[model samples]
Target: MQRSYSPSVRRRRLSAQLRRYREQRKLTAAKAGAALGWPQQKISKIESGEQKRLPAAELDKLLDLYEVSGEVEREALHECARLAKERGWWSKYKSAFPGGLPDFEAEASAIRTYEAQVVPGLLQTPDYAAEVFRAYRLLPEGEIAKLVEARMARQGILNKVDPPDFVAVIDEAALLRKVGSAEVMRTQLRHLKHMASRHNVDLHVLPFAAGAHAATSGSFTLMEFPDPLDASLAYVDTPTSTLYLEEEEEVREFASMMSRTQSDALSPIRSLSLIDKIIESSIEE
Candidate 1:
């Protein structure tokens, strides 16, 4: 079966391609908009992926304006435009995850995550995830259940035939913090060890002894794509809002931070050993 591309990823890929083409032609957004007889705002929106439903005729015109004549390149970009207009599986829970990070995550070639407070969402068990939502948000039971279900569904990506390379560095404090109960935490810790064993997933733990290191502020996920034109995206999920950064410099800084944090963390072998110790402790408690 052919793989389906997420609209979020498609949009971003198309946006970056369009912007690069214009830049190569030595045209600013305003100049490009003027040449195409379009408003500057439309150019900005299209380049930002905010205008998801870009007409093919307009895309063709933009290509013509940018002198993109090669058939192969044109067809690839045409496919991107087509995919951007289509919704992905996560669109069903659009309200709960309005930021579209999940869709980007679904299509990533690699995912680098750093967490200082809690277990990464992709590694969370259902019970542990439920407790996280319950403690952090004041939503009704029905809403919480829906969110939890959506979160679990996100994990399906890990089981794909070609799963992304997953690397996560977690704080020891997150391991010790009790989410639901001792039983819940015990299960969660065991699950972490199991996930760490996966060939594609690399798990590390930052011990408290390695204090005041990189990424001490909070957690963020850095997503990479197979297509170089797609660039990299850094996702920071805060209590109030979710922020996605696409700037080259900002994304580079996050990538650097991941390297630093990983250096400060325990290796996979030792991390699993620490997790086993935590599981035993949780069981005794």
Candidate 2:
């Protein structure tokens, strides 16, 4: 069960709907504000989801201006507003995800990830995750443990009754590169096999034979929501900062890359077979 709703995502949903409604009425933000006697920035912020709180009265006013008459429609938007103000389980370990990946991930109906060097975090084991973080070399032992804990907690979404459909397109190099000890790698491989078998998860491996690829630069995650009002999100993490791209043009590029990579990667069944081969021949005692 999803104990909490992702405020950021909900806000995004609300904002996108509000913007669409305003556009449908051909009302500019400034005009909408002028008619409602509101500050221009207030309307802009509400539509952008930059504001933290939206009073019920103000929402009603916007709906009225937008001619949103249906009770069901109004109620749904109101629910989105209410959920937009709520928090999720990752509040405490905020530092681990400066990118707000968990926020979007919690409510995502589907998640597609492409990795050029490492396993997707959602599919990584505790030991494997710790080893990867340790390679950062700056964090203290305690900090490393905290990150690992948070990473594991994030996996809870996968176990929920109605989990997000997850698709992972991983590079062959990532599978071959040992993260921890040989035993750790073995455990991690088995875990991957187990997870890939799940009904909602689709795992593929991009073999070296594929040669050049679309996501050659790095890895990225794209999250899709069930609501049509909420646009898909494209997340890219860099060494210096994180990017949350919501524009369709930018998101389309990432989606295209993922699609192309998936085409080149082995099928799910063959991918699993390849995993077995890796474990048998490369992973040594």
**Tens-digit lDDT string for candidate 2 (106-182):** 88999999988889899999999999999867889999999999999999889888899999999999999989888
* Residue 240 displacement in candidate 1 (angstroms): 1.6
Each model's lDDT comes to 0.90, 0.91
Off by over 4 Å in 2: 283-285
Model 1 residue 154 CA deviation (Å) reads 0.6
Encode model 1's per-residue lDDT on 80-136: one tens digit a residue.
Answer: 889888877888987768787778887899999999889999999999999999998
Q: Judge candidate 1 at residue 215 and give its lDDT.
A: 93
Q: Candidate 1: minimum summed lDDT over ten consecutive residues — where?
A: 1-10
